[model samples]
Target: MDARWLILADDLTGAADCAIAFRRRGRAAAVIWGETAWDEEVPVLSYDADSRGLAEAAAAQRHAALLQRFHTAGRRLFKKIDSTLRGHPAAEIAATLAPLRAVHGHAFGILAPAFPGTGRTTVDGRVRVGGRPLEDTEVWRRDHRYETAELGAMLATAGLASRVLPLETVRGAGLAGALAEAASVPDRIAVCDAETDDDLSRIAEAGLAMDAAPFFIGSAGLAHALAASAPPQGLDPVRIGPDGRGALFVVGSMADISRAGARRLVAEGAVLHLPVTPHTLLADADGRAGLAAQVAERLAAGGDVLVEIVLAGEPDMSLGLRLAHALADALASVAGEIGALAATGGETAAALLTRLEIRGIHLADEIEPGVSLGLTLGRFSIPIATKAGAFGDADSLVRIRDRLRKARTEGSLT
Candidate 1:
């Protein structure tokens, strides 16, 4: 009988790792997980198919990487792979791994991560395989809708009914608390929100170090902001209520300010509201519509005065592009004797001056994520910042806020 293989696939790297495990013994291969009905599952294989999209809840570069990693040699490889697991669930996967498995001779298995609410069936609990419990391995995984489908394919091929199981419980401290179930190896953890590239460098950093990490699902506001879809709840950013508006700055997103705790910063008079452009709102289409409108309305209502306490909304691309013209027209065209407009939001903070055609300004408030302060008293020009959404990242929001505070206290705006 073939030995049981519990493949762990989280993101693209997770998938790659699964294939790598069997590379020395079984045929390990990669397959592009194309899109399909959200709740559908198929337990069969046909080599001729598109790659599956590893929906991160995944990022753009990560997907692009998957496309780059899975390089098929030829139809012959597929033909040979198809012969072994002719009627298997993950036969397609088996076929793809045939070449590697042929050399290694170990049964092929897939490892995947469990996504929230996506039906997952796991037969292997936190038990040992030959005195080696699953929990103590170098990696642990879960499955989303797509990986679950692949697993179903595997079970069907092995002539076993689908088994659903939960991953081992993790408990500890800080992020380590999240990894309690796994063996301690100083694993790298990354909050992946594929819509943006903010955390890519870090995620890549974590991924490249393979053996020391098991991906964990953390609630990062930035991840949701950068995701292609607006996450169901808090991931979505909204303009703060009028009562909470402060000196609007630039380079911020809903994720930065959506939290009840983060909102507390505003409620306590730490952050303010700054003017935004229509260009930013339009970039996200409906996503930034309401907030952009609010920013526009505030600026129109004579709020463009020399204020020093507001923050900018998300680094709305459309807003960043157009706000300069709007600000130029407002300042140069309308508000003669214009001095400087305060701002926040990372991308907007950085692009405002160039976009608005202004030369410079000064920084007034100093605040940040960790509460450390920064002051700027000299070269205060158009206060611009690198925003989270500008590069499609969510966690950048926290950094944006922290940077804002630090920038404010560190130097005078220019």
Candidate 2:
């Protein structure tokens, strides 16, 4: 019960979803950025490296630096990667194992990015999303760093030795022994196959029984299994904040899932859509102010507002970062009026939080699979929910908005 775990992720949503795995299990979990101080009482610490959009070398470097500071004794390490293999998993895995090898004399990383609840599974060492090969998915076609969907090949490209533990081995009774045998070899990483949460739980049981310090690499599914395997500490119940006057929903992703969710919200009449174009955000300061005033007035009138970055035709992917920051800056003027915040994409959430001078978040619960609900820690201490751009369905946003509304009606403010 005294053991601690650190979940390091490439983005904010990844960090929160994984950290919530522990928080939901009666453990104190927090998601923080930079070298900000963490409460020692919390058993789980998830940090966002914010390297998903960076170059391979830069992403690896960022992971290496963060591991140097957080990879301390008595704490288990979990490297949270994208379930669709969108980020630099191979390079980041290498960086995560470096410190372990230096300190423990041997390092074994188990990579299993399967979230069955969300239709992401690993079989034969290849990642699949919604029954299709990852490469065939819209997310991959739009942006993917891997040449192949095979986990072994991806690791091999990064100059790391990897082996696949087939599903038969994963579900067998000898799983613990097989895992121990795999860990005996130095610098060897295994991409374990999993199709269900039970399979992931079996993997967690085996990995936790190993004598050496094992490094975990996966998405929220594996994190949930590992968290469940830990002994309960009887932590305090997490408090969900009550709704303020109204809610502010920010959508900055072009992913199909996010777009659908925005459209669903509009259809349900749950939120008033306030679309701002990139040109106005970048070139027109007064136009930005006008948009902010409109949003604030809506919030003051007790109406939920959904502000999205609108684009005509196909979007230029290169303008994503600039547009995210511009939109976030323009929205900061109404930070005080934002009673509750819901952001769709990681970059948008990070930028908006930075502009609002918020340092960290204490995760309370999960609104749905891959969507996390929490309260901000620093200056803007309000209720917030974060969701990955492509993780949820159309009804996901409506569900989140309804939860915040219920919390307000029930007077659950902490």
Candidate 3:
């Protein structure tokens, strides 16, 4: 099948989650980042721009360059943003519109950044999480770059014109006409309000039916809507079962959800937990080698292991990146023995996979709303699950372990 969709994300977890949406629908989607090149034959391709932590201008430049390189005829575009609006979304959206307008006589974008399964919803052009406004959430307080969570105000800050489609209009019968009319205005973006998967599906259908192909901008929720509406590719989806060896889980995120999940799994005596400080990870060669040997020995004995970075408190942005790379380096040697891999945090996943020489992941299933199960595309083909740090519950890691075990025993990706 020809390439039909191109998804560009600012980080690794976002890329995997969105691509897996299509994979679940048998679209043969694959996610690639870092040095991995594009594959034209893949029906759906998700590319991580790795600009989540960059300044606004740098992030915009990175996305603009990626679009010029990857955007092509007959391939629809999807811009994946953080559900909580943590990254350089406004700049990136403006960058996307400029290039698309230059290429296609007119360019229009429908922004619906809601993933209901993960408790993120857009109401009145503002984001709400778990019945609370985004500004009240811990994530926004800790990591948000923008001063406001108001969608139109955020876009306006970047000098982009935007109109909010209230829930009333989105659910109305004339959504398609409304979207088309909004698109006729140059550089205007439609910020849609949606609270559920069904609401997102309605927005997607309306956008798809327009006379011109609209550029989609949202989270995995929007990706799922588009994937469900996609035509059959007639290509056999890749089915991967697990190997008998033990699984290796890496928790490098500072999110409470991730830490709670790891703690629950360890407290249950399901796996051996090895918690190391950032100092230990960045320690001398012998120290790092010893950690690798211990991990490898556990996996070689068919025992699961959990390797986590224990920070005293939240490190600054630079330290977080350094810590992830250090953790990746410590685990590089045992990467080959990993029968199954699960990682939390996009930067952590990207660093570890790149060190392991994995080119991409052929997605298979979504273990949860923000978690994706897939197999490595290059070098090693082990079963892998990728999850964003803030998503899932205290039992998320336990569920991941159980799911990996079941997949190995059943010899299917269910």
Candidate 4:
């Protein structure tokens, strides 16, 4: 029987980004969060647990519950964690393994969270972004829950035993045997080092060669390798309607990468750029309506629009959530005029979808490495694309806009 895959992520962008790995390989994949119907024969289902910001205990509990509901003996499980190790990876990994271990008599986790395409690599079980240790990077300094950048240490703090599989061993011919030996130890996780896509492919092959199913943990890099190793399933593309209305782009992240991409879009002059502050969104109803009307008018005239949240002075972390919600509300007011949607951050995408009453999205194709284009399946059915806050380069947003425009014109987006 063909192996069914389950990708459980902490947020919407992570879920869609990973699911597109399977979709690109011609396997049927869909991303859903909250209550939604599922097709048993879809082959791959990526569910967003939406627990990135939750407390450690709460995140673990949420993942455990979702695993209990969706996990089965035959399904190949991939726990999607942030490439930079931002979320509760240690806790979520343990929560995922508990029920599996109970049923299989033993379970081992094979984690490789390196997405080399995006400059994230694991060397000697330590995560590095661009050539710097993850802890020393801006991402970790801004929002990190772990005490260190070492994978083994993080796992140990979560009460889990782990061993690092160095790069030499991973790249050697004895990889499969080494992984088998590692899996022999009950509840022991083997954190493999990978520096490139080929390294990830080797790890995927070795991990899949095991007799019993081992829980796989990684980012889209590993997912792509695993999906490639699976049996061929012909692509099932969805038809995207012609773009007669304007597309909407929402930027809700304060990350430097996201800001750079938005700036590039503005410089390109391909879309109408509108910047709003949290105070304006929260206190100015007339201002919100007026802004929405302007966006709607632009969209109705077949022009693309980009709306970004800009802070006035010093950063106010407390206003992030409120500003996100306000942006979502403003977008919802003009949902009818929107022909397509592209959101940069996970939280921003989730809020926009919820406010628009969209239940789920059927992932169609990937516009770029981390950018996923799909069709909305619920209340607001339109072509949409999503990318993580910190995944792409300055020109990533411009590429997305061009791809969507090309897909719409060619009438073969799916």
Candidate 5:
């Protein structure tokens, strides 16, 4: 009951996934964003700073300000970064360390950005996705803020000194001592390489045992590790079930993984598939309303509906955010009929939920590695699930749909 956790994520999906990590382990957790009023009584609180699409300096400033505003003496801090090293991770990490140093005399960060279940790992101080170097991955090519994938080099960009704790050190008996020594210098970050959940667990355990507890920095993998190490709080978690309405899916990511998943889900023919084009999203209000009306009609009839953005040929990457927001706008009209909601990508989730006037989500389960199931808070309490753009397999969306369907039929999460 004494352990309070504050997870700061740069995007909505990251916030929900990290918060659900704690929730899965019996802690009361919620994800909030954009001035949302959070319950202080909740043992775990994850805040989406929505800085993933910002410039490096702006992302850093946002993280610094958020940390200063939310960090309390009793609450432990977890900085959630993208597994692929997207956004301004180094700048954000440095920003996080600054305030922690001012508050705790000396602050150190333990960075382990590995989500093995999703094929993201750090080896030889370099990040790899699906056994390929991060820089060689499509995700990095499509969206990246750094020139290299070397953890130490990336951290150095922000003037923070870092040393890589090789997998051997992480698995060795001297890990605790090594971490304590590595973090002895102020503003130092220990970048640990992890290829498995066990390695991450060891790193989490060692960091927690340090003389001066270091702030954690990682994706959902490390969050899961820390959550496993935490003592149970016995708080009642928010549960979600079917509300006798149809499910709504919003897919806004152009990533291949998400695209393929959406295709598979549509191919199954279980839901009414509506493909929306970029031009349609950018068009007049009438076009948008027409799409929303069609979706609402299906939902009103108790039919599952999938609204996906279809990017034909090569798209202008610059318009990704704009298109996501526009898609959210087009779907806003159907929020009231949404019994269960699942959204892919952070931008789409944030924009759509904000439009729905939902202040936050009370996490219920981790449906998949990086997919989170929760209940919306604010205008409605329907079941909602969120996933990062590049976290799941081709069948990920299908699984999410099945989970939501079960929740609806069973009236509770198992």
Candidate 6:
């Protein structure tokens, strides 16, 4: 309930841990690790940043040690990614971020650890990934889990305890529905784990929607996804697609599971933008919203539209609300009691239900940290399966997509 300053960073866990470590005595703050900037819409814990190591160092070499881990993270996440990832982490000059250096190159997994406390120590200056020197290009390309480790270390040093929650447990359960018992806040933000730079852009969209509620999106994976269905953005060369649709999330990534899964989501209507606010996703659409307007027009024309939303990105809850509003508006004219709505994608189902206020829900599984997908079927009287940005393999999407398609055709409400 204090004046908490939410810091949008490459990793929310690091941000949270940093807040704990860098506390200035009177401030009450915390971090909500996310999959991407867009997934911030769902506060459900199914989605979690791989905050394995992030603790402020008690030793003088703490910051330097962080740089070493950063190198490995770069390799894990960005190293194996194609040249054009939509939500890749922000470009970090190796020389500026780490210590050992060669020809300076870019790193996708940079921690946005806020300089908390009364005094200030900035990380923006170019540093190197320490430990035996190497050229800039030699720095690890994409390592997401390394970022988690950094967060864990920082949290430990900051004297904060972290608990992992399984988001899958709350599937089909709306935020206000079963979780009403959880420590409630006026607003909660979810972000894509991010594997690209533009993945962080959802912060702008989320900021507009949440207003003063306080939230943002960003992460080591370098991308963000709107939990409500929407397309992937920031695709290279293509900018906006031939359909005039813009490419979404252009981050570097080495995670085969996230890469393949999110790509498919971006192609289907599952990834379309959903906004949130008291008024819904369009909390800020002033008729000038190009993408929303375009999607709306297509829907109004009675066109069979399917939007693909990236669950891996972990967008902000505020943005998810906006995205939900869009999808709901698309279905606004539906006169049916709804034969059976099939919800898929990480936070998509949950964001939609929560935004729609579908009530009566219960978690079927225990919450697991870093695991996406929650399942619940009650209250709302409909089956809801939500993803939280953790997919083990590329085939994961194919399986889920198959299940969703089958459910749609077979009327499998369970």
Best by TM-score: 5
Q: For residues 119-173, what per-residue lDDT tens digits would candidate 1 score against the true structure?
A: 1112232122123332332112211222222334433543433322223211112
Which residue pairs in candidate 3 collide?
none
Report per-prediction Cα RMSD to one decimal: 18.6, 1.6, 1.9, 1.5, 1.5, 20.7
lDDT digits (tens) for residues 101-175 of candidate 5: 777877888999999988999999999998999999889888887889999999988898998899999999889
Report, for all candidates in order, the number of backbone clashes.
Answer: 110, 1, 0, 0, 1, 154
- Between the candidate structures 3 and 4, which one is better when assessed by TM-score? 4
TM-score of each: 0.25, 0.96, 0.95, 0.96, 0.97, 0.30
Identify the superior model by lDDT, candidate 2 or candidate 6.
2
> What is the lDDT, from 0 to 100, of the residue 334 in candidate 3?
92
Lowest-sum lDDT 10-residue window in model 1: 76-85
Off by over 4 Å in 1: 1-66, 69-262, 273-400, 411-414
- Residues 252-274, candidate 4, lDDT per residue (tens digit)? 87788999999999999879999
lDDT of 6 by residue, 1-414 (tens): 112122332232223222321122222222332222222222221122221122212222432333343322121121111111112222221112333231123211222211111111112121122221111222223322123223223223333232211223222224223222221321211211221223223322332233222222222221222221123222111011112122111111223445566566545654344322323234545532543455455434433233343333443333543454465554433312232233433234434444444432222211121221212223233222333232234444444544434343443422
**Candidate 4 residue runs with Cα over 4 Å from true position:** none
What is the C-alpha local distance difference test score of each model? 0.27, 0.87, 0.87, 0.88, 0.88, 0.28
- Error (Å) of candidate 3 at residue 100 is 1.3
* lDDT score for residue 396 of model 4: 95
